[model samples]
Target chain A: MIEALFAAVLGGLLLLGLHRKVIARVQQRPGPPVWQEVLHTLKFSFKSTWVPETASPGLFVGIVLVAIGIWTAALAVVLAGGSILIIFGVYMLHKIVEHGFGLSSGSPYGKFGAVRSVISAASEIPLFVSVAAIAVFTGSLAISDIVAYQAVNGPLLIIAPPAAFAMYLVILSKMPFSPFAIVEGKELVSGYKTEHFGVWRAGLEVANAIKTSVLLGLFLLLFLGPLSPFAFVVAIVILLVSLSFVCAVTPMLAPFDSVTIQALVTVVMLGYLVLLGVIP
Target chain B: MSSLGGAPWYILEFGDELVYFTPYTTTLLILALVFTVLALVSRPERQVEALFGTDAIYAKDTTVDQMRFRRFMAIACGCASMGAVVTGDLFNFTLFVALVGITNVGIVAAVKNRHVQNAAFQYGLVALTATVPLFAGAGIVAATTGTLSIVALASGTVPQAPFFARALLCLGVVGEGMAPFYAAKAEMFRAPGAPYVIMCSLSSLLIFLRVAEVVMVI
Candidate 1:
């Protein structure tokens, strides 16, 4: 479990670096080194950290810890091959973390970010569709059981492409530079994270990296089936590259539009699930 | 009966009826307990100037009593949520849900802002009306199954409930601020305090979860 946590954090940072480089190349500019995020994390860790005078000191500090804790729990769940329902529950609980992050600071920017977080929370419902589809196909909600099913029946992506596509969009919404990034867009001066600085901000960044790794790892596990260590590394690289390309080409959507697009996708995914049931 | 450290593990009886506690209920109890402690330690954001006005703001300021009341309501919300999750009796679950709703209002009712007060009032109205279906559903279940005990329902000793009663139970839970009704409660979140305000959302969520479990088991 500790190794899984470490891998999620480190691998997530590396993936962020890779994303930066990929986006920079797309924009016809030289980006920072592939290890730039690693340096950024190290720098923030050593820097002095403090709670803003205007903020609720306890919640401000507690939220950062909660952010890290929830992501770590998500990673551990995935690594341990626990029930998917628990993973979904943890993912839903993240809305509280985001809400706490924004409201604890008492900044309008943070509050707006928090509101955006709430609005975008509707995006989580589509994930349920994916989980249901997988459960229908694999007959189990346990990650290990799903992996075992895939070993016999082949990758779920082959049987349920629409669900896989929905999961991909869910991952995109979480990644930087996507339309759903409106919560922390430039206009909000980093949104809910505006008040966090120094080591506290670093903690959030590390947590985000782990979250990225966990989501991608989950996507791979669900769609690509279980893989050898080398294959797993390759899968992560391929997934990150694809996500970077999408992030590079797309502009951030207005908050309302982002929610609309995700809601539309969710409706479509649900329709697909219904059709899957009707056809077979 | 099975026991955990000398305490009863499976059943808790009240008068002629009983409630069952399974591992799922235990898990949710632990979760509510953890969040309750988090609510206690976390500080409330004091941003009255931002919400109302910058001029002294003495009139609308939260009094010590109001703050204490909010704290009490938050603790009550947590306890009610734990009760809703752990109780094996359908009627007891409804009672806990109602307590959770009322305390959810209390958690934010102390805020002086018109908008916050209005939103809380609106939420209170919804919660008040929601009890109709909540209790009606439980009554319907008891009339049909001859008991309100979830253990009996789950053990297949009782007949399955009709769709109308199940839908009513779900309706009552959803009325407590899920989806369509959430808009009425969303503005209540603008209340200045983070810790107590969070309980408003957390309690509703926990009740919704417990309701789902109850509906499935019953």
Candidate 2:
């Protein structure tokens, strides 16, 4: 379990770095190496760190721990083949963690970021629609059950294309530099992360790494079902590269447009779900 | 929690309430506990605001009296969320969900900012109105299925809840402050208490998660 977690963190960082590289290459620029994020986490960790003067010191510090704690628990859930509802729950909680990151520091930029996080909360609804679609097809929320269903039937990707697309959009929204990531928009100076520096920021990086791994892994688990270890790596890389291409071609949307697009996608997904006769 | 080391698990049940933890509710309860402790220990941050035209920035302190009230509301919100997650009864779940919305408003209403006050008022209205559907959904389940017990409902012993009841329950949760129409809920985040303000979002998420599970089971 420990080794799996360590690999997940390192592998996830490399994937994120690769995501950056993919975007940079598509944009006609040389990007940092795939190990850059791993190094970035280390660099931040060794830097001097302290709670900000204007902050609630307890929450300022505690939220980072909570952020990491929740994701770590998420990793455990995925590994245990637990209910996918827990993964959805963790994704939602990550928003509050971002909000906490912004508001705990009392920085105007962070506050704006936190507010954007809340406003952009509408974008998360696609995830629920996708989950519902999956639950409809598989008739279960547990990961093991989902895998069993896929094995007996076929990949949900082929069976439920619209559901897959909805999920793809949901994952796209969370990938760094994706059009919908308004919470960390450049204008807010790293947005919710503006005020978290040094070790606190490093802790957050660890959490993000875990989150990236868990979400991507979950997508594979839900759509393609179980795979051998090597196949899992190959699958997630293909998945990440596809997501990167989407991120590369798109411009970060104005917040309202981002929310509107996600909402519309959710409505369309829900319509498909209705057609499935899962929803009434 | 079922097994400290992955042993085969048995669900632990409490007395007549039949309250129990599935892996889902256990996670929710842990989250509520974490944030409740955060509210208990964390002071509200002194919000820093800048004078728009100039370089001047000042930090506004949260008042003692307001802190006390928001803290109390935050804990109440947390407890409501915890209850919502663990309750085995649909009626109790609605009651707990309703308390979560009311306490969410209380958590921010004392901020003394006009923007926050206005938003909270609007949010409170929606939250209060949300209960009508919430209770009506539970009421319908009771009327149609002849029971409000989720355990019994999920047991497949009773008649299945109607499609409208399930839809109403979901709609009520969304109205309780789930997104796509959370304009007032977003505005209420402008309230200055980080720990307290967080419970508002957390409670909504918890209730939403719980409702999804409930709707599926029943």
For each model in turn, which proportion of the native inter-chain contacts is also found?
Answer: 0.24, 0.63
Docking class of 1: acceptable
The runs of at least 3 residues in candidate 2 whose Cα sits more than 4 Å from the true structure, single-residue gaps closed, are: B1-16
lDDT of each residue in B1-218, candidate 1, tens digit only: 11111122577777655755554455456657767777787667765344355444321234678778898899899989888877878898899988988998999888888998998898888889889998999999999989888767866777987667877897887676453235556678777777777777777766765665566456
Question: Residues A1-280, candidate 2, lDDT per residue (tens digit)?
Answer: 7998898899889999999999999999999998999999999999999998989888999999999999999899888888888888888889889989999989889998998888888877888888888888877777888999999998999999988888888888888899998889999899999999999999999999999999899999999987999999999999999999999999999987888888899888888888999866
lDDT of each: 0.77, 0.87
Tell me each candidate's TM-score.
0.85, 0.96
Q: Classify candidate 2 by CAPRI docking class.
A: medium
Backbone clashes, each candidate: 0, 0
Best by DockQ: 2
Q: In model 1, which regions exceed 4 Å deviation?
A: A276-280, B1-29, B48-61, B86-91, B129-171, B180-182, B209-218
Please write out the lDDT profile of model 2 over residues B116-194, one tens digit for every residue: 8999898888888888898999999999999988878887888899989999998898878554676787788887888
Candidate 2: count the clashes.
Answer: 0
Model 1 chain B is weakest, by summed lDDT over 10 consecutive residues, at B1-10
